[model samples]
Target: MTTAQIIYEQYKVLPKRIRQELKLLINSEDEAEKPFSLMEDIEQGLNEVKLIRKGKLPRRTFADLKREMNDAK
Candidate 1:
């Protein structure tokens, strides 16, 4: 069996919640790793989404950026 097959078998043994959390920790922007793992990026993204939902962090907007640039000049 290939290394990938082994890893797949190991991952299959993980508890659903733990596997999900591991995915979150490994999140990245590159899709190259996506075929290997989609749940990873999604889990991290979910946290970002939740933070924005809570209003604790400033939400991003195109108009806000324009206004800031204009003010700087």
Candidate 2:
């Protein structure tokens, strides 16, 4: 397997709460083009899978997130 697969295997064993922390990161990626970057997004995506193995927190809606994000700018 590849590095991603290896990491995924590891992620599959996390508990239920620590995994939810990644929600903060995932929820931050709804914009058309996020400020961080594509590479950063990809890295975050991997982190998302990691969180999922533990337990997926509810995903925020795009509209609410977009509205909140725009308001911040």
Candidate 3:
């Protein structure tokens, strides 16, 4: 079998969440070559804001974010 065929066979057996993550990874590779879109970013930010307002996601402070970034480094 070809490399892609082998990958597909393995991909088929993955759980739904993992398959979704893999799809995102694959799409991100393609996106690397594309120009940045401010509208797309605005839409994503709006969606996150909606989720946060609904209490589906926790709100985070800039200090907490900066701390996490510093810790990562």
Poorest lDDT segment (10 consecutive residues) of candidate 1: 28-37
Which candidate model has the greater TM-score, 2 or 3? 3
Worst 10 residues of 2 by lDDT: 25-34
Rank list by TM-score: 3, 1, 2
Candidate 2 off by > 4 Å: 29-73
In model 3, which runs have C-alpha deviations exceeding 4 angstroms? 1-35
Tens-digit per-residue lDDT, 1-73, candidate 2: 9999997787778766756765555676655345787999899988887886677854557898899999999
Clashes in candidate 2: how many?
0
Instruction: List candidate 1 stretches off by more than 4 Å.
Output: 28-73
True-vs-predicted CA distance for residue 20, candidate 3, Å: 32
Q: Candidate 1 residues 1-73, lDDT tens each?
A: 9999999899999999999987877675454454635787799778878999999767878999899999999
Worst lDDT run of 10 residues, candidate 3, spans 28-37
lDDT of 3 by residue, 1-73 (tens): 8999999999999999999999999899998879658999899999999999999989999999999999999
RMSD (Å) per prediction: 13.7, 19.3, 10.9
TM-score of each: 0.36, 0.34, 0.52
Q: What does candidate 2 score on TM?
A: 0.34
